[model samples]
Target: MELKFKFAIASDLHIALPETVWDHPSRFHLVEFSIPALEVVLSHLAQLNLDFLLLPGDLTQHGEPDNHMWLTARLRQLPYPVYVIPGNHDVPTVESMDCFAPYYRQFGYKNPSRLYYDCEVLPGVHLIGLNSNQFDADDGQIGWIDRVQLDWLESVLSRVSKDKLVLVMVHHNILEHMPGQASNPLSKRYMLDNADRLCQLLHQANVKLVFTGHLHVQDIAYSDRFDLYDITTGSLVSYPHPYRVLTYERDRDAERLSIESYRVEAIPEQPNLQHFSREWMGDRSHLFMLNLLTKPPLNLPSAIASNLTPHLRYFWANIADGDAEFSFPNFPTNAKKYFEAFSDRPPADNNAILRL
Candidate 1:
């Protein structure tokens, strides 16, 4: 049997309405780059005749109700089905609002008011949706999969056959690139704090591939024991302006599951960070990501963050109109070393699929 579908993935669009809904000292402007950039990506995606659009998370800046409303209205106009989950910003950081449930109402399963939901994107392929954002009354927060969601997950997994293509979607990553994803002070402590528990759950069910955003850097993580891969894409508004498209198929006899990765190149004038470190080392705020070297796989810590921040902040202010890049040419070796270490997969003929 042959399974062929084309899908588009973009994250950290941080779409804003015409109004200035929220502000952070670090972000360029809510209404300026993100919304327009999303429009461009969506327009391009439509031309590709995509089967579906996987918006991993952060559909709006700060999870504003109006911004959420605006985005869905636009999504309704799209020609394909669009699936979404909430980024930390898509939920309220403040205790009162907790805006994520509303996003589920518009783009999630059965129109529920939870960030976690699932649906069938293809006849034999399943997309299990999840909501990873949760906070306590005392204002302490952790990215734990609550009991209700876990129950929901188990029930969904039970229905899948052993021979099926299952794509798990969520906003925060389970196995992040950096080691300190849970401990970093720079990221407002975003991540499924109990990601280990969630990983166990996925492993038990034989779920092998997960797609996530929110860290704003492109990297890959794999669980050797379970052979599960968690691939994170870079933000549209951040360095490299990266994105991805995946195509899955089985061998001629259908015993092996194979997948191919299409690394998104920046559109001629797309924006990329000379240093992903500079834009994210500190609390950049909701709608944008803190892609500091200190967080997760990089784990650069304070001294390095201090040193690199100077070089990074410049390009954020004035990236050129075309092919906006935030790379450090002066420090070539460091950059090369960074790329070699952080990538999810080594450079190869991407046209060939991996036998996962």
Candidate 2:
């Protein structure tokens, strides 16, 4: 059997037009060029004759009525099929969730329960979209796969042939992409609350690939226990803005997966953005690093954390810039050694082929 298909992934779009761009003191979203940035990517992808496109989620700035409207209209003009899921920012509240189904009615869902859907995207590929959004009493968002969706997923996967490729899509990390991703307080929110249970089921079903967003970092984390790969794409509006093109092939003789990543290096009005975005993020990394070091997994003192913040200031931007080879030789011994753990690369890094 020779199975081959081409697809593109662009996640965490944070598509904020001029009016939807809100003011926040601590916010790090560079969403001013969300539209133009997407246009640049779409313009490039439109010519590639892709089999399909996977948005995975964060399709809007804040699930704004106008923003969703803008994105839906824009996607309608595209040449290929697109499948989308909702992210935390897209469904922050229960009340705001009503608009998602109707806005993207054409994309994936078979009926009104449009938050999640399953469809046959190609001859031997099943595309499963899962909604990771749930609301708490305080109206805050959480990432979880509800029981109904899980049951539905099991039913769908049970029927798929073993030869068929299963591609899962969600808005949260399903694998630990960072050092303390699953247990660390600050990082846990970016991962699905019940990732282990979901992983067990997918692994049992021989699902090899899952597409996810919501860390705004480009990472490919494999589940040693489950034999699954969670390919997380970065945000289009953030530094080192990235998107991916994946090619998967399977035959009687071999099975292989290859990934190629590209960054939106420039926008119409933001010339030389690749150089300036790193500087902008470096300037703002102090508070973020302080919180990380003082929080769980490290628990360093505030003064010590502050002193260490500058050394690891570009740590996150580097992670977001995928294929990161991070090392800290010039820092204090303990801090340098501790931060190095997060930078370790997995065997299946980007821009390469892996035998399945």
Candidate 3:
């Protein structure tokens, strides 16, 4: 039998709370427009009759307790079921470790206390949420599921019905969206170190589709047997902030899965934002560069790849921060070896080029 379900997927919400609860610069994400922009998006979303909404991660400006509380309260009021997983920002960073409860509470995961678990959001639609964010020195870097979680995952997959479609949700991409696996530092710590092993598990079980957001760009990737679609939804505080609605269905023959992606642009609604509304809208064209770099998944420089993350962040901030006449240094050579997979171009999207 064929099953059809429509779900709305958006990520990197980066919700900022009221000013009294924030600290400037430290509260770097409190841009002049995210909250109001989000309000418009959520209100608009209510008009869509979606079965559910999947927010992969980064629901808060940071791991701030109040931010989590405010975001969670808002989520609870959404019109449909909402599922979430914690992003590095939503989870505790060095600055604060107490934000997970409210963050998790707002997300409504299988078990907030547990890093990973499954939720059957609808009949025959199993939503498996994985906590791919964690440190494991034994793996030589940050991010990896522990032996315990890995074993549990294997066992869980064994029980899923092959007839049902599986939609995996996580903050990091299990498959490469572009090339340099170590390119972007923001995602380095959340990528599953044992990603290949995880792939084996999902593939063997016929997990045809997976959704993810991190890197804040939009792109897609596929394996013959299965496809991994990555949508790095723009941050609420950043320019070109976006969201999308996805529909998954079986081909007429019911022999394969067909997924369609639709991009949703930002809509702002705030009085304070009127001053910088034009600025907040950002350059749609620069987003092309971001799409290019993140196409394969921030496979930035693999070595000091994480270090170079700061470099990319600074460049964007300079431009987004309204500084003109800025100069960006050449892509660091140390970072060259990491982007080998993306070094060569295949075919540009002829139809999607910006008319610069």
Relative to the true structure, candidate 1 reaches a TM of 0.74
Tens-digit per-residue lDDT, 1-356, candidate 3? 56666677667877776662345433334444556767766776788778898888777776666777777788888878888877777664433433464356545643555767687888888888877666444533345666787788888888988777677877777765454444555445445567777777777886756667665544444554443333334355554355666555555564433333332244434444423433333322244334445545444434444444444443333322221233334555533444333322321211111110
CA lDDT of every candidate? 0.63, 0.85, 0.57
Those runs of model 3 whose alpha carbons end farther than 4 Å from true positions after fitting are: 20-32, 94-107, 136-141, 183-190, 224-232, 255-356
Which 10 consecutive residues of model 3 have the lowest summed lDDT? 347-356
For each candidate, what TM-score against the reference? 0.74, 0.96, 0.70
Ranking the candidates on lDDT from highest down gives: 2, 1, 3
Ranking by TM-score: 2, 1, 3
Q: What is model 3's C-alpha RMSD?
A: 8.1
Winner by TM-score = 2
User: Candidate 1, residues 67-158: lDDT per residue as tens digits?
Assistant: 88778888888888888887777775754234556544645556554557777788877898887777778765556678888888988888
Mind sharing the TM-score for model 2? Answer: 0.96
Off by over 4 Å in 2: none
lDDT of 2 by residue, 154-219 (tens): 999999888788899999999989887888888899999999889999998998888999999888
Error of 1 at 115 (Å): 2.8
How many pairs collide in each candidate, listed in order? 15, 0, 10
Model 1: weakest 10-residue lDDT segment is 316-325
Best by lDDT: 2
